[model samples]
Target: MLFVIHALDKPGALGARLAHYDAHKAFLSDTSALKVEIVMSGPLVADEASTMIGSLFVVEAADLATVERFNAADPFRAAGIWERIAITGFIRRQG
Candidate 1:
C-alpha cells in the first residue's frame, strides 16, 4: 500500500530543521536505496519563503506498519522538529 506521512513542525523549530536537513535528505536517499519507493516528498513551507513548517511524503510500502517504522526513523523526528505527525494509507485513483 501507499502511505502518506504528514509531519508538522513545532513553532520555532525551523532552526533544528535546518540543522538536520542534510541528514533528513540522506535518510530519504537511504530509503530509496533500500527500495522503499518514494512517490513524492518535500518540506511544507510557510508564507515566508525560507520558513519551513512541515514535511509530506507519499511512499510505497508493504503495509502501514512499514511506513510507521520509516516515520519513526526520520532524522527530523530524531531531531525533535516534528511536533505533530500523521500517517495514513493512501490509494491513488487517477493521474
Candidate 2:
C-alpha cells in the first residue's frame, strides 16, 4: 500500500514553514520507511505579488497508519504550519 500526504499551510504561515524547514528536511532525510517521490512545495500564487498560501508533496508509505504517524511527527506539524492535512491512498499507473 502507498499513501500520499497532502498538507496545506495556514494563511500567513510561511514564517512557520520556513522556521521548521531545516528540521523537516532533516527528518525526511532520516526517515527510512517513507519514500519521497515528488516534493514540489512553494507559495500558492494567489495574486500579482504572488503570496504563498500552502505546500504540497507526494510521498510513498507502507500504510495509512504509517503515513499518519509520519505526518504527525513532521516538523511542520509540530510548528503549526499546516492548517489542513489530507492523506490519500495512491496507485501509480504510469510511473
Candidate 3:
C-alpha cells in the first residue's frame, strides 16, 4: 500500500530540523530494516520558498501500521520538530 505522510513543524522548529537533517537523510538512504520504500519526499517550504515549514513523503509499505512505525523512527520526530503529522493511505491515481 502507499501512504502519504504530511508533517508540520512546530512554530519554531527550523533549528531542530536543520540539526537532525543529516540523520534524517541517512535514515532515508537506508530503510531496509523498516521495509518501506520512499517513493517521494521533500520539505514543505513557505511562500517565499526559502523557509521550510514542514515535510511531505509518499511511501510504499505493507500497511498503515508499518508506515506509522517508519514515521515513528524518524529523527525529526524524535527531536520534536513536528508539531502535527497525518498519515493517510493513498490511491495514487496519477503522477
Candidate 4:
C-alpha cells in the first residue's frame, strides 16, 4: 500500500530543520529494515519557493504500521521540526 505523509513545520522551526537536514536525508536514504520505499518526497516551500515550511512524502509499505515505524524514527520528528503531520493511505490512479 501507499501512504502520504504531509508534515508542516512548527513556527520558527526552520533553524532546527536546517540543523538536522542532513540526518533526515540520511535516514530517508535507507529503509531496509523498515520495509518502506519512498515513492516521492520533497520539502514544502513558502511563497518565494526558497523557504521550506514543511515536508511531504509518498511512500510504499506493507502496512500502516510499517509506515508509522518509518515516520516515528525520522530525525525531523526527533528535532521537533513538524508541528502537524497527517498520514493517510493513498490510492494513486495517475502520475
Best by lDDT: 3
In terms of lDDT, the poorest run of 10 residues in model 3 is 23-32
Segments in model 1 whose C-alpha atoms lie over 4 Å from true places:
32-35
lDDT of 3 by residue, 31-90 (tens): 989999999999999999989999999999999999999999999999999999999999
- lDDT at 30, model 2: 60
The CA lDDT at 53 in model 3 is 97
**Tens-digit lDDT track for model 4 on 50-80?**
9999999999999999998999999999888
- RMSD in Å for all candidates: 1.6, 3.0, 0.6, 0.7
Candidate 1 structure quality by residue, lDDT tens digits, 5-68:
8999999998899999999998988785444788999989998766799999999989877787
Q: Which scores higher on lDDT, 2 or 3? A: 3
lDDT (0-100) at residue 13 of candidate 2? 90
Q: Give the higher-TM-score candidate: 2 or 3.
A: 3
- Estimate the overall C-alpha local distance difference test score of candidate 2: 0.69
Model 1 quality (TM-score): 0.90
Error of model 3, residue 14, in angstroms:
0.5
- lDDT against the true structure, each candidate: 0.88, 0.69, 0.96, 0.95
Better of 2 and 4 by lDDT: 4
Off by over 4 Å in 2: 33-52
- TM-score, every prediction: 0.90, 0.76, 0.98, 0.97
Candidate 4 residue 52 C-alpha distance from true site, Å: 0.4
Q: Give residue 84's lDDT in candidate 4 (0 to 100).
A: 97
* Deviation in Å, model 2, residue 11 alpha carbon: 0.5
Candidate 4's TM-score: 0.97
